[model samples]
Target: SQTIHQWPATLVQPVGSPLSLECTVEGTSNPNLYWYRQAAGRGLQLLFYSVGIGQISSEVPQNLSASRPQDRQFILSSKKLLLSDSGFYLCAWSEFVAGAVNNEQFFGPGTRLTVL
Candidate 1:
């Protein structure tokens, strides 16, 4: 029974402000974590992922960064938010099954950020 949690369901921040978003998982151990962003009507874009604690992989170069301080915790941060940073941020987790063809991920209720 794994569950992922994301905070601050919605946010509105001025441009150039700092940003921090958090995600945590319960009932699982050493699961693969992921961060995704979805703009208005676009598909989910992979942002960052972690295989384990202190291990982060970025899928694309962007104005944001991610960190994993613990096995079940992941954080996304930006020193200065940009106008393009506004979007829906989603956190997901999947079981680490070796050689598996597909790892079904469970996603959290995303946080909608608006930069004005």
Candidate 2:
């Protein structure tokens, strides 16, 4: 079975601080990894995605960046977290099984972040 996880289920950070959140896959290799941010009551905003190691795509222009160093490891980072950066963060993945990409995605429990 494949699974994804994000750390610090809840975080309280200041207006500007370095940020590092990690996401990883356990039973799948070379799966598409996505980093998304959802503002309160708003929809999901794709920050970045990786198809493979060192390959990343940004769906939105903002203060966040992502990287896939290993086939199953991904990381999201920020040099200076913005006050507006406060929101929910999610990491998700689907099986790389051929023809499986057409299926709907399964999401994990989200991480709630509050910044002040």
Candidate 3:
């Protein structure tokens, strides 16, 4: 069975501080990984994605950056946190079959960040 894990289920931080969020996938090989964020009352927005190690694509130009150090591990980081950065961060992995474009995404439990 495949499983994804995210650390620090909840976080509260002040402005101008650095932030780091981690996600790791188990029991899968070379799966596509992604990072997403959801505001207090908004839809999920994709932040970053990686098809392979060191191959990342950013969907938005924000203070957040993502990295895939290993085949199944992804990390999201920031140099400074902003009030607008408060949200639920999600990490997801997906598998594509036969080169299909619309693959179903499997999400891990998210990290809720609160900027105070």
Identify the candidate with maximal TM-score.
1
lDDT of 3 by residue, 23-101 (tens): 9999988899999999876899999999999999999999989999999999999999999999999999998466789
Give a tens-digit lDDT track for model 1, residues 84-115: 99999999999998788698999999999999
Mark the 10 consecutive residues where model 1 has the least summed lDDT: 95-104
Ranking, TM-score, top scorer first: 1, 3, 2
Greater lDDT among 1 and 2 belongs to 1
| lDDT against the true structure, each candidate | 0.96, 0.81, 0.93
Comparing 1 and 3 on lDDT, the stronger one: 1
Q: Cα miss at 28, model 3 (Å)?
A: 0.5
Could you give the C-alpha RMSD of every candidate to the true structure, in order shown?
A: 0.8, 1.6, 1.2
Q: Which residue runs of candidate 2 sit more than 4 Å off their true CA positions?
A: 98-101
| Worst window of 10 by summed lDDT in candidate 3 | 95-104
State the displacement of the C-alpha of residue 13, model 1, in Å, after optimal TM-score superposition.
0.7
The alpha-carbon lDDT assigned to residue 82 of candidate 2 equals 89
Q: Sort by lDDT, best first.
A: 1, 3, 2
